[model samples]
Target: MKKIALMGRSEAGKTTLTQALKGEKIHYHKTQYVNNFDVIIDTPGEYAQTHGLGHALALYAYEADIVGLLVASNEPYCLFPPCSTCTANREVIGIVTKIHAPDGKPERAASWLRLAGCKKIFYVDSKTQEGIPEILEYLKEDGDVLPWETKPEADGKKRANELPQEESQ
Candidate 1:
C-alpha cells in the first residue's frame, strides 16, 4: 500500500479516519504531533492551521506517496486555494469528512477540494466506515513503473522481482 499523509483543519476527522483505515476501534485521540504509522501519517491540525508550522506539512508530504487534503462538510471556508495541489509533487486527493453531520454539505466541500486541484475526492463518515473501502482499494494499486525497469514477456506477463538482464558480449 502507498503511504498516505493526511492534512486538514481541527475536527476534520483525520485521526478517526486513520483509526478506521487501520481497523482499530474508533476513539478520540487528540493529535499533538506527527504520528507516523506503517502506511499512514497522521498530522496535527495545528500544523495546517498555523502559518509558521505550515512548512512542516510540506516536509512531511515528501515522506508520503500520496497527500490527502481533508475538509469537514460543515466547514464555513476552505483553507486551500485554487490549484493548491500544483504545489505538491506527489499525488493529491481530497477527503470530505462528517458526511453525516446534521448540517453537513458534502458536495460543497467536494467542490472546494476540486477547485484546489485534488485529482480525486472521497466522501466518508468515519463513524460509520462509509467510503473506507474505496480509499483502501486505491492505495492497494501498484505505483507507476519506470520505463526502463522491466519489459513484458512474450506471454504478456511482467515479472515482479526480476529486472532486465544485461546482454553478454
Candidate 2:
C-alpha cells in the first residue's frame, strides 16, 4: 500500500488535513487511513522550526512515499523551512494549514509556499474543507507533480539546495 505521511509541528493541522483526505471526521486520533491511495500518520506538532521533535518527524515522513507537510500560513516564513524537505524525496508535497479567514486566498497562500520552493502547493482549510479534493487527486495520482508524468522522474531534487530554501525566520 502506498504511504503518505503528513509531517509538521503541533497545531499545524496535520490531523485535520488527514481527516479531509479520508472523507471523515471521526472522534479519536487525527491520523487517517482511507483506501490504498491515501494513508497519513499523525505526528506531534512543532511550533518552531528547530531540532528534536520537528527534525525527527521530518525524517520519518521523508522515508514514506509522500509527505504532506502542514504549515500555518500566518507563521513567519509560513513554515517554509520544512518545504525544503521536499528536496530529500520526490514525494514531498507542501501544504499550508489553518487558512480559513477573510484574507485566506489561494494567490497569497501560493505565493508564501512558493517562496519555500513548492510549485505545486495545495491549500487546506481545516474548518471549512476547502482544497481537499485537490490534495486527494494529488495523492491518488501517486504524488506526481506533472499531471502527465504518472511515473517518477529522475530529475527530482537530490539535495536541500536543489529545493527552495529561503532564509529561515
> Which candidate gets the maximum lDDT versus the true structure?
1
Where model 2 places Cα greater than 4 Å from the true spot, the runs are 26-38, 47-50, 102-109, 141-169
Global CA lDDT computed for model 1? 0.91
User: What are the TM-scores, per candidate, against the unseen true structure?
Assistant: 0.83, 0.62
Report the C-alpha lDDT of model 2 over 45-145, residue by residue, as the tens digit: 55234565455665665556776666666554455553475465646667887687554554555676566666667777866778876776666644334
Model 2: how far is 159 from its true place, Å?
A: 44
What lDDT score is found at residue 83 in candidate 2?
Answer: 48
Task: Flag regions of model 1 displaced more than 4 Å.
Answer: 142-169
Q: What is the lDDT of residue 72 in candidate 1?
A: 98
Residue 64, model 2: lDDT of 67
